[model samples]
Target: MEKRVVFDGKLLPYALLMPQLLITIIFFYWPAAQAVWQSFFIQDAFGLTMQFVWFENYSVLFANPDYYRSMVTTLVFSCLVTFFSLSIALMFAVQADKHIKAAGAYKTFLMWPYAVAPAIAGVLWLFMFQPSLGLVAQAIRALGVDWNPQLNGGHAMTLVVMAATWKQISYNFLFFLAGLQSIPKSVIEAAAIDGARPARRFWTIIFPLLSPTTFFLLVVNIVYVFFDTFGIIDSVTGGGPAQATTTLVYKVFSDGRLGGDLGGSAAQSVILMILVIGLTAIQFRYIERKVQY
Candidate 1:
């Protein structure tokens, strides 16, 4: 009973696919190829000179202690962001799924952060955690705790992680809410009739049904932490406080755009791209096995 669209002609199919093919080539493949090519070369301070030292840039990058530190920072940031964003969003979605009064307004408030730009989100958090004039920062200091993100590396990392996690929560909430709504109520009712507690029903029945959605969000959250958090980190901390919040993506921008190390930056970009691709592959290979559907 499955009907398929049959192409009338080969040329017509090719013509229809041309636009997407051109875009992928021009935007993705071309830049990736250019980065790979440039990673092997050394460009001087001026645009006039170029030295082709194969693998020297990558070798120097690996030897640099700052690069390894940035890697560690990125790993920690990604883990924290992914965990907090997904878990918090799931919690909110669960609450909002209930038939509470003014539920629409509550859901709307929770979802509003997704519409805000990442830079704007970071700035908003920065204003509240400014350490000097910030309301939250003042309250924290009043608690007899020294709170200064500007001078403390750990504080700076915490600030960026909070901003990034907040920015992503709304996105994850949307998906989790949708996943929850898609589950059959009859299944939950049956579980309840079987004397299953609310928490047990959620974990054993509802959550298993949502495995596909959870798996998809896991991949998306990882990618978001890797690349999309650049704006938040840049606007809020600018990878400051001794590079505590300097992720791989931020390092690429800082080293190339600000430090003017084009070759090294390209190498970093290449490595970052490879790392993300490998992580995604590993997730699909191993993690996906646990997903019910």
Candidate 2:
């Protein structure tokens, strides 16, 4: 029999949960509520007066063709970031899981990037790819390719995608490494004895077992790309030579800060929130069904 511990008082259990509940209410629920409320009103440049326009802000937002472009850009960015980050991290995690002599050292080095702030990561990548003074840019130019992210929208998008992927790889690597280690050695050995090559064993056994973790990470990486990469966009391209790298989150900031359209910005935020929730639901509803666990 398993021993169980219970709190003596009902109120004590609620008391223990109070702080977290309060945080959720204050930080998350309150801001969300405010955004929803504000989306219906148009405010002045100074935010001095607000006029309720119902869905005018949203109507205007939807009517703009650039909004659709931003949507497309966001979809492409999220897909690229999520796919590359997971694939690269899985590769590194597999290498680390092999019980190498310097495994601990390698893991420590790999995870260090996760600790670096997104803004800093963006800046680091900027320095490495910044057309004239950048070493990598110089090397690329040397190879007969004219690589200037500042002048080229495609180059700018590629730079930010690379930075975002690199920053997130450490996080995915940590989770992948843990998931890989949790698989039983006997299962792997049995697959090997059955004449399965390493690649076959991995695809048929290791990967299937790791599907739950993979699914969870997939959702997490999407959210990370949506919200956390805001700082990276700010520091690196600042939405680019054009609106090339401007994701929806950055578009919200642009409307509020640069454009001074508070209502429009609020509307964009609300839509972005809905978009994230919808994506998460779609993933859990469809993708989770495929998980072995």
Candidate 3:
């Protein structure tokens, strides 16, 4: 009886996970496979005819300057947003881990932004930055700085980065907070007893202990900046100031939904997926090994 009971217990988790496994296969894996299939073929307008072109889409994408620029812009956006979000999150997490008064309140407030939808956040930012009525624009003008997303590609890129970082900081902070809390209290106390300054302790102990969380956040944040937040780009800048803010995903959206270039959009999607997969594989191979756990 005991043996049978133990066997049942072992099977219970698998039973519970079956639904999620089925959903993943149906939704995630199936769609990915279909996308890969569609990438090499062109579909007729009525979906009646399909012909494989054998990398023709990829060839055209590579040959196009605009596609390359969009790819580069996406990479730059992901890197800058990840760097700034992680930096700010770590700083706040460290402060919260000290159990400062009102730290819970601070954390709650910081995380509230993440609860809001990205599209709504983009609209809110637009309201705050619009040239004629925006407080930020007025302040910039008052300071004698020419801040215009209409004529300046750099400013448009900066706006997108800023909006992305704002939405990302809270998510990163939650992870960092958990990482900080999981550090053994005795280890920190021992370091302090040895006359280790805060900076030294952080560099030699706390930061190292937090490496796994940092790495996880890095991957997730990169993926988020890549695929998500298109609404933010669209609402705030419309990929404008001469397409400076037109990241790869945004370009895919514009081509497919707006320009009716289904084949071209599908090709761009395949390229984006490949880029993400390659970057993720490299991270796991190199960065994961350096993480303590």
Candidate 4:
């Protein structure tokens, strides 16, 4: 029998929940409420006047073709970042899970990137790939390949995606490694004894077992690419090369702060929140079924 802890008094249970409830209200609910509230009102550039314009901001966003472009850019960025991050992390985790000399050192180095701030990571990659003075850029130019992220939209997009993926790989690796370690070695041994090749064993046994972790990381990596990569995109591309790498989050910043469009920015933020929530809901409703756990 499993034991369950129960509070003796009803008031005590409510009291125990108060801290979390307060935090939710203060941090999450309040800001969300504020965003929703602010989205309806158009404010002047001088901050001296305000006008209630319900749905106008959203109407404007829907009408603007650039907004749609930003949407497509965001989708592409998120997908690429999530795919590469998960793939690279899984590869590293598989190697690290194996018994090898200096495995701990390898893991330490891999994990060190995660400790770097996203903006700093972006700067590091920028230094490596910048068109003018970047090491990789110089090499590519030496090879006669035109690779100027500063002036090329496609190059800028690729740079941001690579930086974002690099930032997230370590986090995905940590979780994947933990999930891999928790699997039963007996199952793997049995698979090997059954004449299954390593690749076959991994696909049929290991990969399926890691589905839960993979799914979780997929969702997290998507969200991270959406929100957490703001610092990276800002530091690396500043949403430039003709606004090609401008993600939805950065779009919100551009509209709200730079463009002095508070209502529009709020609307963008709300739409973003809705998109993320809807995506997660869809994943849980459909994708979760395939997860082994």
Candidate 5:
């Protein structure tokens, strides 16, 4: 009787969690485990031949010049997108938090971009930057500057970063606005009573309280830029101008889809997973600690 009761009690909580646990195992954990396993070997003979290579894929990847360049491009793209998106989101959030009229309308308008699909966003940007038909391109030419991604690697990268950052900013802004609203109004009033200037109050009180939101958004934005926005790269630059915009994720896609290098692609996926996990761990260990409750 005692054993039966204990078993039933233990099973109840686990039964309640079974659906989510199964979904995680099926969708996330299984694929991840497979990718890690396959990274150590190469497939041949139409999936009939398998040999344990033990870091050969990684060795070749690190030795390849194109891989190194892709890694660098990915890092730079993630950093620039995260920084610009978070900064602009913070600015907009602060403005939207005020008692100014039309704040709701402004926020709605700003958030419209976030609703657009990333692939569509990329196509829209492409149209806006077309050298002959693009409005911005025409303006740049009028300023005696030739803005051609086809001819300039740096220009291509700039276009990709700008497109990705534009899509990310609205999402970050939503989080930041929520964080701002959640802050206790009394804290700001107390700072004002202390004769603190508006800028000082913001820097000393508002910014600190917003740190938790900022940290959360930072991690999310970084991961999104790293993994999810490949559509922007595909539509805007196509990793073009001599592979300047070819990021790690883009390389993985190209290798798997175009190059027929499944094992290599799997290796890249594993590396990317490791990189994200390592960065997230570091953020939780150090950055999250600094965030105010």
Candidate 6:
């Protein structure tokens, strides 16, 4: 027989959930509702007049070529950031998981970057890669490559991608390390006893067990690249070298706050929200199938 615990007091459960529910309503739902409502109307630059233009803002947004460019930029940026951040973090986690000296200090140093603010992280990278004065830029130029991110679109995109990847790696590393630690040592020992090499053991035994963690990190990294990378793009490139690094979220900021196209920005935000939801749903539906747990 299976044993079960029953909660006789229904109000207790509701009471426990109230705070979180309220917070979600206030922060997420309210803002989302506002964005949706505002998407249908156009606000003037002077804030003195408004026009009710249902779907016009969205139509104009869709027709804009730069918007499509931003979408492409966003897709590429998200893919690169997600791939490098997860893969490199996993690599580091694997190495750090070994019985090495000063392991605590090693992990502490690895995790320190996660505590840095995104804008601050971007600024730090910017200072290290600034074409005229940055240390990394100087070194790259010394290698005979024309290293000018300010004038080169490709270089600007690369810079933002590097900064974004660097910002996210520490977060992924923390989770990967936790997942590595959680795997039972007995199972690993059993695999080793079977004459399995270290790489074979990791790919065949360890990796399969880490699927759940990897899947979770994949979702988080996608979300991070789509939304959380705004600060990095802003502080580093301001979405430039001719809008080379202008991702969807950054475009939203550039349009609304900077360009003063509030309605169109809101529409972009709605579309972005929908796109992320669709991606997450697809991941959960298809990708989750491969997860061991």
Between prediction 1 and prediction 2, which has the larger lDDT?
2
Model 5, backbone clash pairs (residues 3+ apart or across chains), number: 0
Q: Which of 3 and 4 is the better model by lDDT?
A: 4
lDDT of 2 by residue, 1-293 (tens): 99999778799889999999999999999999999999999988987998999999999999999999999999999999999999999999999999789899999999999999999999999999988889999999999999988879999999999999999999999999999999999999998999999999999999999998899999999999999999999999999788999899999999998999989999999999999999999999999999998
Residues 30-127, candidate 6: write the lDDT tens digits.
99999999999999767788889999999998899999999999999999999999999999999999999999999999998898899999999999
lDDT string, candidate 3, 121-214, tens digits? 8888887777788899889989998888777888888888988899999999999999999999999999999999999999999999999999
User: What lDDT does the true structure give each of the candidates?
Assistant: 0.93, 0.95, 0.88, 0.93, 0.90, 0.94
**150, model 6: CA deviation in Å?**
0.8
Residue pairs clashing, model 5: none
Scored by lDDT, model 2 comes in at 0.95
258 Cα displacement, candidate 5 (Å): 0.9
**Residue pairs in candidate 1 whose N, alpha carbon or C atoms collide under 3 angstroms:** none
* TM-scores of the candidates in the order shown: 0.96, 0.96, 0.92, 0.97, 0.94, 0.96
Q: How far is 39's C-alpha from truth in model 2 (Å)?
A: 0.6
Residue 151 of model 6: what lDDT?
89
Provide the clashing-pair count of each candidate structure: 0, 0, 0, 0, 0, 0
In candidate 5, residue 108 scores what lDDT? 98
Q: Looking at candidate 5, what is the lDDT of residue 4?
A: 50
Q: How far is candidate 5 from the true structure (C-alpha RMSD, Å)?
A: 3.3
- Residue 33 in candidate 6, Cα distance off native in Å: 0.5
- Candidate 5 Cα misplacement greater than 4 A, ranges: 1-8, 44-51
Off by over 4 Å in 3: 1-17, 44-51
The CA lDDT at 228 in model 3 is 91
